[model samples]
Target: MKGSFSISVQNNTVKYAFSLKRNITIIQGDSATGKTTLVDLIREYEQNGTDSGISLSCEKKCRVLEGNDWNSHLSLLKNCIIFIDEGNRFVESKEFASEVKKSDNYFVIVTREGLENLPYSIEEIYGIHTSGKYSDLKQVYHEFYKIYGNFNLENKIQKLITEDSNSGFDFFNSVSQKKYICESAGCKSNIYKKLLESGSENVLAIVDGAAFGSQMNLVSELLEKRKNLSLFVPESFEWIILKSGVVKDVEKILEHPEDFADSTEFFSWEQFFTKLLTEKTKGTYLKYSKQKLNPNYLSDSIKNKILNLDLLAFLQNSVQ
Candidate 1:
């Protein structure tokens, strides 16, 4: 529920080894990539144990969730790692998201369709990769690889785009300071459209990486086609503020947020960061508000502190 879990599952034919840390992990790839095969192995191991010729190893219980009675099946699980194969239509529903928000379990979902209702991390999206056979040559080796790599800006940015309509947008818009255009896409789902419509030669789109999983595939495809586009995805604006050293005694928490962020309490790391920032800054000059950024955050010292952080330091020359 809070820590990472590594899983090793295999039969005589193939082996899969991977680790999942967040509440939601997405596995998606073209056909014949062993996406379904991995799930099948898990199901087989669960149904027949070692007798099924399949071996599954993990610290936590691993099982599959499916069928029309998924809500019931999910309700009984706790502190588990659940696997849901593709074709589980319930995974796309608001009902499933609601349940996931309340469940104390990690999910490894295989699907080509985006689950907008679920606030999963873009970093958690992965695809299967086959890398030859095992030592015995009896089992094929399979592993998970991140579908999207880190985004870095090699060229100067001429414009800024945000997925937020309020505080985040306000902060970046203020940073642009009329030198460059900064616009908000209004929401995460609209970021791609704004990018498609943005004809600028150099643009940087800022978004909440913690909840941007649903848009990664499509947006990444567009990124491949457009050389001038760049993405700057942090956990959230609140996370940026906390990481700025504006908050005291937060180094440990920032280093490993998973230790503090619980699955049931927070649907995504962004939500946890929002709550953490709001609570830590309450009744102080640095008080946080998502509806509108506190003007104090725009001050030279605070602004410089934020921009000085390594993750955002690149924006210093652009904003100036």
Candidate 2:
């Protein structure tokens, strides 16, 4: 955990050789970069205890923490070389950063994005590269900052004003007007029933994509049977604004800064919303959304999906 070590592989397409001199090392690159493959080979070498080229200077056993299963190996995390691969969803988490900072273990994290609030120094990050001999492939200061870019970390402090839903009778006071909410979920009759409480009518109906597509039968039934009701998703509404040019850039409309701590150009929605709550809101600031999924994070193929959404017209019509 305190010294340098190297992984020297033979007859493999992964990292031919990589060395770590710090307590925390970050290996970041795009997908299919042979990141996980290297971790597997290292783990296999350690488990087999063969004369493989992996060299360890620490007393603790070497382990590869794969996926979300990294948490299961927590007990063995101390004073060892902890190699955590991407896709675990913990790479961008603050909790993981806090936990990692509290220990003396050495970490080799394979991720496409950088972690926030980590203890690692700037010299710790390296852009992993494949397709070279062990002599030519050893990683150096990759300056991931150039590849990913920088972001805004402006934290806003405000008074903690608390309010309760029961404290306001606004929704209840206007109850006789027949308030309605629409969501996307189809084919789940029980869900529809639950949403449509006795006096409330369709209290929880949804068009949730996660549920399934629209059921014409149920949609028509609800439409005919229920009056003074409406369903809308804020995201769909957002699409409307975008299609109409009411707000051209999603980042500007959402008021989420087109910045991220790591992928500077990728327009991080998480940091943006976090800014709104901690910076721009009144009352109790409720931060929403997570992950670094925005326009900048999309691949060219799937990037079109974000632009060619058919819901634009529907969103526009619903709003108007």
Candidate 3:
């Protein structure tokens, strides 16, 4: 039986020592940090067999595919190791994330950054680094170019973050406001007709809460039109507030929406244009207004909310 192998950085030497147990391992770091290489090494070892029972069951390991085909892959890899490369790409699908969380077997997620607020226990997080060099930079550029067919460095970096499983931003930054756009009346009528034809009582519809009154008003309108219908407002609203300097007074606004009723609803294009001046002068003023009254008290509330609600997951799930 082959055992675990170690490679030396100085000599590019490989040595087999002991075997690793079947556990979930997350390889995370910045781009070109050898995360993919490390996962490939682990995969190779599994295929070749180590000194111990840690062996690759190729028949059991399944690669996730796009679209509805995941069901077939899930059935095949149930209770087995599933390798998810660039796991962040699937963040748009809450159902997919839910399924992965529900899986009983080990999953080795290879990501550029760690998956934050995931339910599964992270057995290990390995940070891989590369000695930056001219040749190394050239190799990275060449590989990316071959894959994407373009060499715009900034665009490539953005794409890398999106593709890499473990890579994502931790802190919140509001760059854009999320406003729900209602479908045209014709489209809405078609949707309702389709739902009725299918014998479904409820259909998911997106509506601009701003055009209505508040989110509550939008919900009430939907209730009047369709029975049993449920509406999900994306958490992007919170990000907008945070990014736009509204978080400092979220509690106050939530408590007294009538006070800032007009300003508290959906952000307008006018607001976006003026966000810079507002974020600098107006934002600082609003932020300090609450802080000046009870500094430590508000800070404590924010912390408590984060811990209790798993704010990271809330933010991610809300936006996506």
**Best TM-score goes to which candidate?**
1
All-Cα superposition RMSD per candidate: 4.1, 16.9, 19.6
**Model 1 per-residue lDDT at 312:** 77
For model 2, the local distance difference test gives 0.41
Ranking by TM-score: 1, 2, 3
Q: Model 3 residue 267 lDDT? A: 28
Choose the strongest candidate by lDDT. Answer: 1
Provide backbone clash counts, one per model.
0, 13, 15
Over 4 Å off in model 1, which ranges? 134-155
Ranking of models by lDDT: 1, 2, 3
Task: Please give, for residues 168-274, the per-residue lDDT of candidate 3 as tens digits.
Answer: 11112120013211122222123233323322322333221212111232233444555434332222222223333334544554343223322222122222223
Candidate 2 residue 230 Cα shift, in angstroms, is 52
Residue-level lDDT tens digits of model 2 in 1-320:
34456656544433456666555676765666676666776677767655665443334456777656555576556667778877778756776766665565667787655454453434455565655644313343322212111111121111111011221112111221222333222223343453344342323222222111122224334534654233322222122223333222345534322222222211222222334433322232221122222332133343333334553222222222
Candidate 2 lDDT at 196 equals 47
lDDT of each: 0.83, 0.41, 0.33
